[model samples]
Target: MGAWSRLKGAFTRDAQISSPEDLLAQSRERRSGKVPVTNDSALRNSAVWACLRLRADLMSDFPIDVYRKVSGIQVEVPKPPVLISPGGSEVGMKEWMYSTEFDLDRGGNCFGIITERSGVIGPDGRGLPGRIDLVELGSVSVRGKGSTITKYVIGGKEYEPWDVWHEKQYTVAGFPMGLSPVAYAAWTIEETISAQQFARDWFAGGAVPLAELKNNAKTIDREAARVARENFRAAVDSSGLFVHGVDWEYKPIQAVASQSAFLEARQYGATEIARFFGVPGDLIDVAMSGSSITYASIGQRNLQFLIMNLGPAVGRREEAFSRKLVSGPRFVKLNTDAMLRMDPEARARTIGARITNRTLTPDEARALDNLPPLTDEQYGQFDRLFGPRSAPTPPTTAVPGASS
Candidate 1:
């Protein structure tokens, strides 16, 4: 093989596309210095907001379940210290969920620093993590075995990875380093932001018909030009009048926002950026998507979203939590029932079918509906409806009228 071919092969095989260095090289070589979405200004984009909203919904709506193994059976971890007020005093599950989601989605990593020693013990004599502080993604850096993160360098202090619970997206480097979404799609996001800004500025940045106030008599002074500018703005903006100076003729300087295709380009960019972040472009581009095509139902749409986008991502999170938080049969489960909640009638039918198939129990189905457990009377009624007496009643030997 040629030397050049060998080098090309190496680059293709070893290219860490997720790394900022390679991403920057590509953007700079082709795009005009793409700006990272980490900026405060970049977060204002509608597409960015949509991505954030989706991540937040996934994290917060799907509740966390902590379970422990006792003997040979698995049950809920009795008063799991981590779940009970994870985000320190006063903050609870909701706060923990959002912040963690924010970090994992944007920075590709979420950390929970075990703090606040409660100085108390559980029945098993396991001293609980009193409080959990979420470390800022930008503040921590990894240092350890193949990115196993032996230490988290935060605020000039080093912390053991064990002390700071971490959940990170898988990477080629085998380190816990998560690729930043903003960085990965920087070029697309930057272009979108630029186009939107251009449109805004074109309309609001003193856009007006320029009339060459050619004072052939003498050069116009600064004060005179300033007065003329103010007058021109007031005349054009306030009223559709053309106030001008002496010996000045109108010059057509029409606003060319449409001609520039600023909004169109911005919409395209927004859609592309949304796709880059695994959000459906149509969610942020209603006008572009058009109304002819429609989802059969919201449930189907959500199911598609889960299957095509979030399924693998959720699985990665499950593995991360299971590997880091617990040792044995104890594991974490993200209850996606919230996302699976269908239309009332649809849900009822589906649950009933599942019960018929014996895959889901009546109690389990009721739990999905957020209803309390059935009372004895309700249970008896259910038994009568579909339980032990599912078979036909024994044929009576004695006739109804003439009893034995």
Candidate 2:
């Protein structure tokens, strides 16, 4: 069976699996055809209804966490909020409700306790007795393929291009129940109060123009783009763009600079026209830093491996963490393996049959010509290294500058 089919079968046969239909039926039985309409009773009924609906929805959306969350409902109740507010307000709550109680016809079987509370004004301008809250009905988890590594053996030695394969699993906990009736009622009342308060605040001169907010957001985006462009330029410049010991070679640094400038210009233009903007040098910096670290780490790891395989004489370390030369044979072997895994047909075409003491036929040469091109850009660099042309030639003219 396919992987997904096997997973589905396992899930279907799980003893703890609870279907949404079962939960809905239990909810119906709990009400016993008598839907509560009173404010307090209605709220309780709504909470129960929410639990049923949530359970059903989560059964389809998060099948993996179903068993654990449903079975462990009793255990998840006392746990602190998976979500909460900073001001000690019970803004978010979580609870797990089980199906066993429903099956046994127990009063509290299908229910989960909600702890957090938010007060809301009633229609009579009085505080509502109950408040809106969140609860967790169950938990779900999923696992999938992670990382991959490729290795190749040539001339009685083995080389690895990528050396790690890791898998990741995710778990989420929340209520399968719908919103609590009391919470909904409280929220409606609170919204009415909030609308009035908002009107007061707005008339009290706290409200600002939507255009102004848009302008501010745009300003922030432009500033962020400017900063990003500056950082990118600095990085590229420091890395140096020139091709050493080569003629008429185009520098990749110029392309990087051009791309960075284009991105900056586009960002500035977007800031001028767009209504929404992002914060400058905030969370984006964290992401950029992470990306930099990932790229650097991978490059460093590969370089280290290559140097080690090349041996001490040619691959001398300039610093404790630096390598002077790398093993060409090992690099080629590893690259071939990676290519084979990524594109088997292409690898087969590139590494055609090698018959001993045989001359290539014209048809064979033609077949070779029809083979797919190499995906790696490094091969082009290698070709240039050994080719007649060795130095990069300056561009005759700069690319047309963008109109401000």
Candidate 3:
């Protein structure tokens, strides 16, 4: 026989002690002086105690499947004939559909049995401090899914089909799976069986009733939580708020920005930009609420305008241009010193001249030194403010009514 089978057989056999407590007391006595109790002892003690507590609750037999059929009856009738008027011909109609549905619910029950064995001899040169053996008999239920179908018919007509969806159920009987009841019984009978071995090593090494073991498991769980938090924080810090698994660089940002820039230009009453971008004025109105600029909305003509009129060309490739705008040498120093230095009226005059394609006055030129700080927010706003004028005018550049 295999070691497990032999251990099981030994446990099933009758023992000298009559009660479970007596068996425990005997096992402790046998090991009292021979082997010092260690952490392993505590675990074993806990398991044995747990088994003792559950011994009375162990199930002797578990339920099994007893398949049975459930019958369903369906009935239908036709309404009496009705006429809209006395002269109208009678009209008849019959019930068109009738059917039933069936399904099964199945479940199983299981139990566990534990036993121990031990032996010791006196100091008479004979065998002493004999081995302790632990054994367990697990009762498990196995079930499988099943199905049934039935159909019925009425005179010269077809009816709906019915089906019974079968589910599996199981219960332990005598032993789990194919094991005999004797083997199941043996798990509760052995003397040297360690409760710890039966409950922990023999099973899943569960850490029940042990604080340290539970804490260790918790520590691992906490570390996992920490790592997840760090990863999420890093992601948010780099890219701002976003939906999970969405590629930030390619998706919603560009889409939203394009939509916003178009809407804002229209809000500023820039019909040319709206039409050039192929977006309606109302859509531009909504997009303007949030500050953003879409490169797609800014055509090549608009980029060219900014490069030629506002800044020096840094670089250019086919269909793409990069420009850099610099303030006067002393403008940065002036901004650092004061905020209310520039008069709005004078600034407006300067902006008007620039808008009207005229040269700046001496006063306006010096006032440019007080230009406001250029932040991303301000830049985005300026794009909406001035972007429309820079947008390409299709009619001006087009040969009227020319076909491609």
Candidate 4:
């Protein structure tokens, strides 16, 4: 059975696996009705591709770091080889993150096989997976029992839960597998695709341009009419100009009303698809009408997107990584400071305010700009130019008597 069919069955408590014959029948039924859509085919839709690309790109750019809680305080630790090279040296962390995140966003589930292990043991008494090779979502199958997945089948081979890595989102109370946003938004995507195809076909030999031409000088026969039509089309196509005598009358055609509506429908479809993927329409260049919310800077826009849309997915991934990839008090965090960085002017102003308020030290602020601490010579130069920094007065008795 295709994963799409299995995904649909997951919503029900009594869902059962269908035999190959039954699956074939279902496939035929779908073929007889509406066209069946697959993940690869769905990408042909511009809006769907844009939404998935935006989500995957943003998630992959953020660095994933490991931290350990020591004495009730969290301290960053070096990431293990599993995180640095999750799919082995062939695939680095950035590419692995992008592939897995792309799958999770599009299919609602990502699966991988544990290929190698490290010497360090985890809580489960086995060494953590040193390398995990991500599997294609279409090639994997899961058997679940009321919110718990029992077995994973990949390439006709069954594996235990510990031997596999699975991450899911858009979860439900009873279903073990996550629900796919692409499946839910299939209708909208298909409609937009159809409209786009129609437009392409219409312009490419589907319909002739509606127009009429007549010669006031004389009446032409069938052969002459064909010659004149071919000559006019050739002239128009070659130079975009058809010169003729005053005896010839030409009237151009106007598009039908229904054809114009398809443009608006496609735009609306893009907005709806962006919403399904939890991406802002503006980020993907989808036009929005009557939008009141505006950002003072790019940082504000990114902050809003992080908080309202991408934050939950990041939290879920953190929990999954912390639970499965490491032992003891170590946890995973996807650093979002890069995504939330402000423009240069706004960043300077904010850092300056923090330094003035004593909430941030000058060196720390400099570190934010990736600069090293100032040396004694540089400090002396600043002192000479801007005068010495202020300091608190020291208490003294003998010094006070001398002054008196």
Candidate 4 has its poorest 10 consecutive residues by lDDT at 19-28
Ordered by TM-score, highest first, the candidates read 4, 1, 2, 3
Candidate 3 — which residues are off by over 4 angstroms? 1-347, 356-367, 382-404
Q: Which candidate number maximizes lDDT?
A: 4
Candidate 1 has an lDDT of 0.65
Off by over 4 Å in 1: 1-39, 68-79, 116-130, 142-150, 206-248, 256-260, 285-287, 290-293, 358-404
Worst ten in a row by lDDT for model 2: 324-333
> TM-scores of the models, in the given order?
0.70, 0.14, 0.11, 0.79
CA RMSD of each candidate after superposition: 8.6, 33.7, 39.6, 7.4
Candidate 4 lDDT by residue in tens digits, 14-112: 444322222222332242334445666678878788888888888888898999988989899998998898988799988988998888888778889
Q: Which residue pairs show collisions in model 1?
A: 147-175
The residue ranges of model 2 lying beyond 4 angstroms of the native Cα positions read 2-8, 11-133, 136-246, 251-404
Candidate 4 collision pairs: none
lDDT agreement with native, every candidate: 0.65, 0.28, 0.27, 0.79
From the highest lDDT down, the ranking of the candidates is 4, 1, 2, 3
- lDDT, candidate 1, 1-404, per-residue tens: 64323323433453322222232333333445444455334578878877877777786778778787788787877545666577757678877878777666765677667775455553334544567788666566555543344566665577775567677663445434555676666677788877666666556754333335455557789999888777777787777787556766556565565646776787778877777678776655533646454788898888888888777887787776565444456788887767877898887788899988779987898886588878888868978888754653566576679845
Clashes of each: 1, 25, 15, 0
